[model samples]
Target: MSRLYGDPIEVWTRDGEPTQFVWHDRLYLVRRVLDHWVVAREWWKTSEGDPGERRFWRVEASPGREVGSYELRFDTAGSGWLLMRAWD
Candidate 1:
């Protein structure tokens, strides 16, 4: 099992597939920080534009980790890069 030593993060995907993520315009390799079970589906929204079931993960790296306490969204129906939640 991979351990998180420095920072905490959250990542999302569709069907739990491995994907490449970019941070600060640089690409970083990503893997599940824990197990295959991470993400939680949105239960508050029932509209057509709401997000569906999402897989979550904690991506880690050096000082500047690619992802930080942010929620990522991957939709098979969209184009371009996936969307990432803002860091507070």
Candidate 2:
């Protein structure tokens, strides 16, 4: 099963890559980055040179012994991190 989330998370990065994140008061360490990508949409319609793109990292992470798949999003415009999804 997969769950979607829009909750803000505190993330720590190394080499501009997500290394750890805290969500719901739980700390999860990134074990591996499964994928990394960017999404930009309707760029021609937006103003201020904003491409409306979001940086995403799909990773395998764990707060404890059990590792889970997580998708983290970085909002370039706001410089905020969000927990986008989780897989169980």
Candidate 3:
């Protein structure tokens, strides 16, 4: 899929679990926390270090009734945030 520039997103954790996320540029609040998870993978093809990994946070929101997750990639090269996955 193609993404526009300057998209807004959020990342959070549930019950002290790893971080998760919801994607949106508009301001909003979490009416209630549902669930959260994390995803980490090695990017050997794009990595240039001993351990090049990407981290993601999957979260379920209530009010919006949206499901998906946020991403946080950490590698010897760099780190950044992204919208990993989403569903209705």
**Every model's TM-score:** 0.38, 0.89, 0.40
lDDT of 2: 0.93
**Best candidate (score: TM-score):** 2
Model 3: CA > 4 A from native: 1-24, 28-44, 62-77
Ranking by lDDT: 2, 3, 1
Q: Write the per-residue lDDT of candidate 2 for residues 6-44, one digit (tens) a residue.
A: 889999999989999998999999999999999875667
Candidate 2 residue 75 Cα shift, in angstroms, is 0.8
Give the Cα error of residue 37 in candidate 2, in Å: 0.4
Worst 10 residues of 1 by lDDT: 3-12
Candidate 3's clash total is 0
Q: What does candidate 2 score on TM?
A: 0.89
Pick out the ten consecutive residues of candidate 2 with the lowest summed lDDT. Answer: 41-50
Residue-level lDDT of model 1, residues 1-88, one tens digit each, is: 2322322223323455544455455545554343233344464654555545554333432224544343344443232233344333
- State each model's CA lDDT, in order: 0.40, 0.93, 0.41
lDDT for 39 (candidate 2): 85
Q: Rank the candidates by TM-score, best first.
A: 2, 3, 1
